[model samples]
Target chain A: MVINVKNLVKRYGDLIALDHFNLEVQEGEILGLLGPNGSGKTTAINCILSLLKYDKGTIEIFDQPMSPDAYDIKRDVGIVMQNVAVFEELTVYENIDYFCGLYIADRQTRKKRVAEAIDFVGLNDFIKFFPKKLSGGLLRRLNIACGIAHQPKLIILDEPTVAVDPQSRNNILEGIQKLNRQGATIIYTSHYMEEVEQIASRIAIMDKGKIIAMGTNEELKKKIKSGEHINLELLNPEDLDLEAIKALPHIISAELTDHQLVVKSGRDKNNLIAILDHLKDQNIAIGKIYSEPPTLNDVFLEITGKELRD
Target chain B: MQVYKAFFRIIQKNRSQIAIYLVVFMVLALLLTNAYTPPQDTDFTKTRFNIAFINEDGDSELVDGLKTYLGENANLVDLPDDPQQLQDALFFRQVVYILRVPKGFTAAMLNGQEVQLEKTIVPDSPSNIYMDLLINKYLNSAQTYFAYLPGLSQDQLVDYLKVDLAEETAVTVISGSSHSANAEKSGYYFNYISYSLFAILILGVCSVMLVFNDTDLKRRNLCSPIRSATMNFQMILGNLSFAVLTWLVLISASFVMYGSYMFTTNGLLLLLNSFIFTLAALSISYLIGNLVKSRGAMSAVANVFALGTSFLSGVFVPQELLGANVLTIASFTPTYWYVKANNEIANAVSFNAGNLQSIFTSMVLVLAFGVAVLGVTLVLIKQRRVEA
Candidate 1:
């Protein structure tokens, strides 16, 4: 285990931000922490990193006490927060070099890492630019480059893709995966469930001040009764077809709008095949069909109330 | 090494204004008190005027005698005008005094009727004192013709004085005293400006707001390996370097310009005096910078303290002439001591060791105030977040 946080408790006056939050990150797994706003994700991170003084907690990283002086342990952790962090006086390259210099001792090796990190984030062209001069997306990329330039063993990313363009977002997601592939353990946090489902091997769904659920994507989805989904693209399906699909024995709920009907069911949600069979028997045809497995959102909504944003 | 590097970078950005500060101090010093004749022993060569015109009489009998007397005094502005013009010259301080004749004055004096002489001046200007001695000398020498003559009426005596003698001297004396007092009055601007540098030094103005701004970005550099405390130390070092650099340049230039006379045996005394002033400035600056949260608050407090101290300490105005009971309260201000020290040193007034001790004591008090502010700032900013 690379990171171990146990029995962590934090309070701000009368309000608790983190309560007995327990989490562990194995050496090479990408653990995504998913939560709504003010769900103690930030507080947990602060406590784990020892940035904040928690009321009661023992955050042990690499199996030792963490402190401002824990150079050897801190040297292996890289964090890209939701907000950007770089000195305004420093240029993009300088900022990356500065953070990287904190870890890597060899100048030549550090230089190579910085160059590769910049290129990894598609920021080679903006290496000379300052943070203030870059667009928001470009600045986010710069922020990522600064964090990962040192190439630590564990990288913590907190909503790195928020408000970014599609291209930049895709690049960042791919880069994060690449960082993981390089044998780095990653702790990622984001409100976007699908992104977590795609990238994280282990997901922790947190709420209030504690992690209410934690599991692999497949296992988490298994927690929900629904199994599979067949999305149909049909313009103006006949009311009889929709009625027949609803009349199926396993069907739980069916929503029809915008020239499509989504039929939902229990564990064997393949009421899709039966509905199609009935549709065919009625001489009806479907345009495009997509069959997908249950996603992290289903798992998340099943575990907690479906409030997307806090 | 890291600390030094941080300080160097900060100094780099403010190099422009640093030069300006030095120049301002230098120029102000040059303009204020370069008159180096040991103010007490003013060699009368610098004096521009002298007295005596034998205004013996308008009668033909005394004309040749008066002309002969005028030929001898090189300092005299010739008195060829009528009584009014002669009197006007004396009133303007162009001549000290004039002897004027009543019509038939020689006949009256010879007939033993009467004759009168004229004089014009403020009592403090001492024009009449000199005139009195000269008149007696001449009267004893030229014969006692007008010895018993009643003097001219104050106004009529100097009718040639523009707007009348009493009228002109009143305004002139008031104006002259105001200028002299202002010109010679103590000032604390130097010390206050110095104190401001101390605040900038301790907090490191270049990085003060920058650190506050960097708090977010989520886990940014703050989560990086470097500790925030080390970063803060670097910033403090940088700011201190800039402040010290500013102080050295400003004080050196001030001395090179207005304070070169401090090189006179009394020079060290002047410098020691000015040193307190500088300390006072540095202390106040630190106090204001640390005590206030916002720049506007800092600036407001800075202005109030700097300007208020300058005025109250009698930097721009003389405390003695300002004549406020509150001045005793103001005198307790650090700036008050600083300017007071400078004034005492520059004037021929004797310097008591006790006075210097008190001035130094005030400087230390100002320094104490600065340290107190620094402590408060350190506490307020201890957590390394945006200060509330």
Candidate 2:
């Protein structure tokens, strides 16, 4: 494991911020940490980075224990915080150079790396602009550039795309994938499930200070009973047709409301052909049909029994 | 070292505020130089006031003696025949005194009858009052000496009295050094400079601190690989560099405006005194920066701590003129000791061992104040580290 955290515990007075939180990031994989606003994602990240003092458990980066004085471990780790963290006084170029210089002491090498980072974040035209002069998306890009200019082995980004425009979000997600392809293990955290689902190779869902579920999208979907859902507009439908459709193989339930038939099925089951065959035998005509595979939202809703956003 | 370099780069970005303070100091120094004129020794040595002497009494040895004494003390212009001309001469400061010898007919003094010589002068004219006293001494002594001599002639009595009342005595004034005047003047200039430096150090250092202490920036820095101790050391180094530069600029500016006389022994003592105060001011600025949470807080701190310290520390008011309670209160502040050291250095008659000791003592006290404040700051910082 490139990064491994075991049984981490943290508390703020009476509030338990992280109760036995555990996480792992393998090499060269984008491990997405998905959670709601108050989930323990940030707390767990802080504990993993040794930025906060945890009451229990261990955080190891590259098999070495993490600490504030763990310079060897810290030198290989980069973090793009949730909030924009660039210096207002420094130009974008200078800001990148300063942070890069902290790790890479060589002048010529650091200069090259800084240039690459600027190009990587698509801030070439804004290298001379101070952070306050940049738009929010540009500022967030600068924040990432500063964090990753030295090309650390492991990068942790906390909500890097929050409040970003759609184009910038795509750009950021693409940049993250590119970094991963360059052999950097990344721990990406966000509440935007689509972004995580689009980029993350493995997803960990956190709620109330614990990793409630962790798996690849397929594995996580399998953990829940929800499969593809089908919505059909029927020309003719009745209670008898609903009971026949519900009794179809692999069909969990079937209902009809306002001349529309809704069918939910269990995992890996194709109930559409079975329902269509039964409807045909009953001389039912379908006006329209639509099917949606179970999304991360469905898996989250099934497991947590609450909306992914809630 | 990288952190240190970055720290100073941020500090240097605030040159405009620092420039404003230096400019204000220079302007105030010029104004102070023009407003205060020390009394020159030559002013008293070159006095020969023009006075009109009216002789109503005809020639007598006593009257001649009086006229001769008046002539010695003043330029005896002919009494203006017109009263208006006399008034004009007096009003215009041409003659500072007017004297009329009464018509004694040369018999009153011979027979020893009481007589009064009428005198007129511009009211409140120091020169007039000065010449009037000289004339009174000359005539009264002549009469008294003659009354006792009994055998001596009037001329001999006048001669004896003149020799006895010469007004020359061995009075020596040691003004510390020939350049003591310039040293004292420079001290006055430094009064304004100390205030300027205090303001600049507070505002400049506080501005830098505010940026470094920004929530996002601070968090980002903490996440970096650099140790907190190294970062703090770099911050101190940067602030010290800024303060030393400020001191050097102000000191060099003083030297340029006041001439190389500042390199003298006592002048150097004053410089050392001010430099020590600069160190204390830096610590004060650091303490203020530690307590201040934002730019607005920095401004409020600069105003209250900088301006308030100056007012209480004899920069705006003389220590002697300050109330006892105020001085007692000021004793708690480092600026009071700084200004006291400055005052002592300015007035020092010699850069002797004792004076040096006293100067160092005051410096130590001010430095102690700085160390004490910085101690509290470090403690508070350490206490706050628990949260970090």
Candidate 3:
């Protein structure tokens, strides 16, 4: 394991921000740290990074204890905070050089690293421009560039794609995958389920400062009661025919809306032949047909109750 | 990349704050003219005289003739019915000098006997100085007429005395004053005052704003990988840079008003004064900046405290007029020390260890303030990192 955090607890005055949160990230694996707003995602990350003091916990990175003077551990850690944290007086090129200089002490090495970082983010056109001149997409890109300019072995990104253009988002996702392919472990956190589905290998759903569920994509999909959904546009059918449709084997539920028949079924839902035979017997006119497998969104919705949380 | 970006981001974010800064500066520039302009009470700088002639003789010749001699030069009030009342007026600052002629004063001058008139004066008043000068000038003229009388007839002698002593003194003194720029000698230090107030405002704004801004941003930067020491050191340098820039601009503006000789002779002294000024500015900025947590709240706190410091430190009014207790309290503010040093330096006839020491005292106080603020910021940074 590259990072291990055990039973972390944190409080602010009378309110608790984290409650016995535990997490682990193995080498070379991309773990999606998923949560809604204020669900202790930031608190957990802060505790793990030692940016916050916790009441009780053990946090180790690379199996070594972390502290203020732990240059050995800090030298390899890069952080991109939620807010854009760059100096206004400095240009894009200088911003990258400063963060890279924090690590990679050698002048020649740092210079090359910063250049490669700018090239990696494709920000060469704005190398001389100030941060205020950059757009939202470019600012997010700059945030990322400043983070990975040092090229740490383990990267933790917190909502790195928030408020970015689709094109820039795609570019960032591609870059992240490329970095992983180069053997760097990554921790990704986001509220967007589609992004996680596209990039994450392992998913951990968090709520109330605890990991509620953890599994591979397929494993998490199997954990939920929701199944593949099939829908078909149907002509008018008698009320007695609905009874026969309910009798179809492996059909967990059926609903009709705007002359459309929607049915939820089991994992191995190939037993839809009976329902189709009944539909044909009724001479129901079918216009269109479509089906979709269970997604990570379904897994999260099922595990975390459908109630708003701060 | 991080360093440069951080620098640029700060500059961009501060743009509006700087606009507000310059606006406040503009208002200060306009309103500060009140400090240098002379107080419009009365013409106290001019030698004013009240001449009272007591014509007790049946013949008004002596008093009438004396009136032409003395009254032409002085502001002749009808010789007061009561001499004691006129003397009281002089004591109460209503008149500069009072000339009292005895009942026989005019008869003696007409009889060609030596006429002695009593002039009443109040020694404790500022007008006494002008009054003495005018009296000396009058004496010299009277003596000249007596010396030249042997050459002329009595009528010519009276004519000469009236023309030279009374009428001519009026013309020469008044015209001499109007000839050159009427530089009022009273409150001459006031121009230094306007210059000093302008300089204080510069220090006040730049220092307070810089300290409050950095201390606020430190909360955010503390969580980042960059050390608290680095962040604070950079902030102090940045604020110091801004304070110095503002001080330079203020000094330049004052020099433009004071003129070319002022710029050449005192430019370096003003520049040196900036160091002390900035030291005080930084110290004050740090103290006031760290007093609060939120940036919005810090602005209010800094402005109120900075303005209070300016008022107590004699930036607008003289500390002496503000009284001894106020100065004792003002001694605690570095602005007071800095302004005091600037006065001592600019007005000094020669540069000596004493002059140097007084000027440097302010610098030392500023240094102490800087160190204290820096130390507190570091501790707070570390403490907050853990608290987070």
How closely does chain A match the true chain A in each prediction, as TM-score? 0.89, 0.90, 0.90
TM-score of each: 0.70, 0.80, 0.68
Against the native chain B, what TM-score does each candidate's chain B reach?
0.49, 0.68, 0.58
Model 3 global lDDT (CA atoms, 0 to 1): 0.65
Best by DockQ: 2
Off by over 4 Å in 1: A13-15, A67-72, A101-116, A119-122, A241-244, A282-285, A307-310, B1-207, B210-214, B217-229, B262-305, B319-334, B348-356, B383-388
TM-score order, best first, reads 2, 1, 3
List the candidate 2 regions with Cα displacement exceeding 4 Å.
A233-249, A253-262, A276-288, B39-180, B378-388
Residue lDDT tens for model 3, A198-269: 888888888888888887888888997768888877766443266667677777678888788888777766
Model 2 chain A: which ten-residue window has the lowest total lDDT?
A: A236-245
The TM-score between candidate 3 and the true structure equals 0.68
Encode model 2's per-residue lDDT on B241-303: one tens digit a residue.
989988998888778766777877767877887888888899889888877898888878777
What is the lDDT, from 0 to 100, of the residue A124 in candidate 2?
Answer: 99
- Best prediction by lDDT: 2
Among these predictions, the greatest TM-score belongs to 2
Residue A81 in candidate 3, Cα distance off native in Å: 3.5
* Chain B, candidate 1: TM-score: 0.49
Worst-scoring 10-residue span by lDDT in model 3 chain A = A301-310
Candidate 3 lDDT, B124-160, residue by residue in tens? 7565565455545554554556565535544665566
